[model samples]
Target chain A: MHSSTFNFERPIPAQPWRGVAVLVIVIILFAAAAWEVRCRAVGYGPTLNDTEDLWAQARRRVEPGSVVIVGDSRAWFDSDLDELERGLGSRPVQLAQPGSCAYPVLEDLANDENFHGTIICSIVPRMFFAPGGPLVENARKAVKRYHTQTLAQRASHRLAVPLEEHVAFLKERDLTTEALLKELPIPNRPGALVPPRPPPYFQSVDRERRARMTESCANPGRLQTRVKTGWSRLFTPPPPPRYIPKEAFEQRIAQAIEARFRDTTAAVEKLRRRGGKVVFVRFPVSGELKAFEDQSTPRTGIWDRLIRDSAAPGIYFEDFPELASFTCPEWSHLSAGDSVEFTRRLVPHLRTALGM
Target chain B: MLGFFKYGNFLLENFQWVLARGGITYKPPHLDVFLPIGISFYTFHSLSYTLDIYRGVMGPTRSLRDFALAVSFFPQLVAGPIVRAGDFLPQLEAPPKPQNDRFLWGLVLMTLGLFEKVVLADTMLAGSADSVFGYAGPLIALDSWLGVIAFAGQIFFDFAGYSTCAIGAALCLGFHLKDNFRFPYAAIGFSDFWRRRHISLSTFLRDYLYIPLGGNRSGAARAMINLIIVMFIGGLWHGAAWTFVVWGLLHGSYLVIERLLKAFVRPTTWTESLGVKLLIGLATYAAVCLAWVFFRASDFTVATRLLRGMFGGHAQADAILSTREILQIGIVTLGMFIVQWSLRETSLEAAVARLPRSVVTAAWAFMAGALILTQGNSNAFIYFQF
Candidate 1:
């Protein structure tokens, strides 16, 4: 509608360096400095995220006599693979996928000819009580999506792992210019921001390192108050008591147990037939999370049924005093410090259960 | 493109269900999303190029590389403003023009577009719309309206956001693409709405489809029939679904009724009044939104249920969304409309150019902040699936 914004009289830079040379460099420097400050303030060092690549790296290092660990995030993150390996005099291969259903991985390991070593799977009640098929569909979806991506996509992801490990700025995908624009409090609309989606990491990271990064990231801004933490706060004034109908509760619980039993047992039998031992480990969960798991899937109700029907040796953490004594900072996954200790404490019990 | 393959399969699936096995009844073994993401759009882009060349409106290109570049221009290659060859091809030969003003303007635009996409469309609107649309059971009145209204905003932002990004990216490279959208929500009539929304596609359909079908020059009856026919095919062009056809029919009916009403209902003086314009604009938007129900729903049953809820069929159903979620839709949708209406007669860059330096910087800062606050794994633009 008006004059051209471009000033054609001015000579342009040559190809491949036409624009934003200085600007891009300046922005990068400024951002790097900002992130350096934030990381230093939060006391987090250069640490790679716990990702699929790291998991693969760990898996590749598994020796023939090594015990293969498989389950979900709880099993993988709550124990130090190195510590467990040292404690048991055997290495550990972590095939434990976060958000994965345990049975499928179990089934895969059972069918493997090369892996005749012991298996340890931690069963969180939610996955065990869920009526769906093994939630290992993520592995399939990831594979499909992976195939569709270009070499550039792969390279970019590979580049991001190191960048994320080093720079807090790269770690914050939501802190982009585009994302920050929408955070302005202009209204006639909702001011609420959608929670950021985690970047898909193809490589494995140090579990301890990632947990620490998460801790750093969750730090509040100046205006934001710190979240209250206490044993009493876990119960609160307590959440409003919810009522589930007896018929619905029992029906769901029955269906869930049946599915878990049918799937887990099949996996265990196949593993046993291959001269490999299968053992279930209940990971340390405490506070409100433990309460909910206990109620939704009582040890007697679901865990006992699976162990009984599968004929696999089980270790309920509650049954052993030391295993249950470890503090779970998040009440789901153990902190980096405690995970090593927890692994050390459980090694003898795990050895006994595997009849090693 | 695999889009045609998917469309053919979709038609066959729906055909058997609606027509009671009138032909071969085939369903794939498993649910697979095999359809190419932006096949429909690229097809139209190429289609427009070919038509222009065939009609002697644009010269045939001798350079295959330039032609390919035009067709596969990455900015709008997938979901597009459907840039025409006459506008974009010549610019390809020109060397890159680097000016701080143009570059900064492009960055500003890109930021705005991304904000519209991930924040407003995906985060705020999509969740609410999905809750109602994907529900197996019935939705109540408030829920249905909220769902559809949110959709009206979502579809607008999603596609417009894409076009804005394309335009901005091209702008940064010193290639100008005509703006694809205007203040579509503020349009005072069906025809006005068409003029504003997806300007390239609408014009192409008008020139290639409507005019060839004898347009308004043919008598009233033939013209009306032509309009309906063009729109019906236009709907089918989006996808092979019957729902799309119904959406077209709804729009066609609105246009016809508006045509009939134009002669008698309006006092010429009243038409100039801002209040009257606002009233008409709102009514037109509501009409467009109702048509969107058919466009968005999976099938006739869902559409029927949605319509029933809209007209007060179900008032007592349990709420599917929280207040915060609804608040999100309202705020984002309102913010979009306010911005659009405010800058109705000017471009975003132009409007910002007129602003004081401090205000412009602050606005850019706010945009950046907003984008960070509302991140999501946004699905591809809604139009890309077409």
Candidate 2:
């Protein structure tokens, strides 16, 4: 069929390379110019996107004595980057992503030869203890991508980093196709038109939370926190048990955590051998969320065991009343002002551990 | 390092199972690894090039530039029509003289490829197929069949879409890539289906592997063994898993059954009656879909569960897919069947080229708009695995 169909007698062009080159140049030029115009329209410059490439670029810029903060969204929001930098001497490099677990980033740093300074890891009890759990797959994915990425990714990341730093339009938090589809008004079928509910507006925390959304997906603004607190006040009653104990499920969960801890311990000890020590910080979680965390994985069972096994010194916030009483607006994270205080309060503990 | 990382995920998982059987548990950190983007296609391309040279069907290319250019030819590099020496190398001898019309036609073909991938495959079919194959809960027969059918459509469009892009892109560069697909959904039988679908790779196997195994020149039992062996190798080439092996064996069984039946089944059943032809076509599609369950599933258990679900051997009729999703899948799949059937006698480009310019323009615009609206995560072509 192939031999029958091919037009073998067709004359070759004099210089197909010229045509290919021209097309390539035109498409690239057009895309670059169009992106600039679009970014400008959005009141942003065409900045490099902050994909793994950009994140890896940031990771590559690490130097000895530069504090690398790695953990989840609590690490992302609860620690004021500026405050941490002021309290410590150097400007901190932020590696933590919102809604991500800590161990992946810790694992990454442990593997890296260049990064010899302290990694102030914010420990979310459930995520650190349950490596294979559903909630923290993002961190796992990020780590996997980093391990498997190509050197060509570095060039692409280098190209995109400027755009990311300048243009808000290129942020990871921007509306994705899946997100837009979820919010779409389209009904699942005909006849029964699913009338879309109006936006919750001032009545809910969503709009306010959304307004505070930055590239990092960290909502740390005063207005956002106030709105969240107001919303939280309306529902002061704690959520019912987030996880029910099933024997097989719990066994797998524990095994998953223990296995990761063992792997992480070897890696961390290697880092220690390389003249760097890893310090864990239990970020403040308040009210119902803290209660849920306490019930789900208490200090003795999960966190303490992890610290002991990994041989990493951990600062549980409840041990220090100065850091502990700062109210978390969402029961998960400290607010904008509270974060600054929290950062100021927490840096000394980290510095002491780092032998600063 | 790349090889280790690429196959590491699969190897580590399998090894963990091996280790577990020995009463030892292992969870290597490297187990959490990403696959090399297009190792399967690359391996096949290399295999085709080497085997043809070994068979003396083609001479070894002493020219490194020509060899590199053919293998790494950008258009078909990642996902391919699975080219051999005769497929692409000779075209690189002289400077290309790509005509503008051919170039424009190439652009149009790229648009068509994008439409098939984005609008039909990813947007419409992927969700439903994923729902069915990935469904942990019980599923009834109807949804299960729809899911499998959607998958058949999905893989076809995804791979065909990529192949079309490769062909068109090569044409633009004044190189000819032979057509990979030829209205495969409209094939008359198993042999006909293989001839139509992924034509290059199938033909490559026929010429190199099948012929080397004595083809049909040998007696019946030996020929059957040869066919099964070729098919088994072909299946394993797609992946490293047992499911792929099963998928290959199933198709091999189908071809064997077809050859055996061809001896006894009269010509009138296939040639003269449209009802019989349609019935046969449907039965072929059903069998193909059954095989695809193994092709698509993670393991034999998942494949068996889905097959059982398709036969109404499930405890629950859970509604995972929405009615709207079902409708969208149905329309796209029907559209594909109708189009492929109509174009069985003629090529897609040839058919389109006959239409009025305005009609073509309108069609392109409609497809482009639909694609823009429904564009998903630009998933790599499905055949990139093999």
Q: Pick the candidate with the highest DockQ.
A: 1
List-wise, what DockQ does each model earn?
A: 0.13, 0.09
Expressed as tens digits, the lDDT of each residue in A85-202 for candidate 1 is 6877766777676666676566666666677778888887666444553245643333334335546545655675667666643333334433333444543223222222222222
Candidate 1 Cα misplacement greater than 4 A, ranges: A1-73, A87-119, A132-153, A167-257, A267-277, A287-292, A329-333, A352-356, B1-3, B18-37, B93-100, B135-137, B300-302, B372-378
For residues B1-386, write the lDDT of model 2, one tens digit per residue.
43474556667778889999999988866555556666655666777778767666666666788887777788888787877755666666677874786776676678788888876788778878987787665567877888899999999999899988887788777787888899898887899899899888788788878988899899987888888998997887677788998999999999999999988876974465877777777788889999999999988888888888899887645545666667777887788888877888887756764676556655655565555445223565787655
Which whole-number lDDT from 0 to 100 does residue A153 have in model 1?
Answer: 45
In candidate 2 the C-alpha lDDT for residue A124 amounts to 74
Please provide TM-scores, in order, for all candidate models, with all chains considered together: 0.79, 0.74
Of the true interface contacts, each candidate retains a share of: 0.01, 0.05
Scored by CA lDDT, what does every candidate get? Answer: 0.68, 0.69
lDDT of 2 by residue, A44-76 (tens): 433333345445555655687677878866776
Number of the top-ranking candidate, with lDDT as the measure:
2
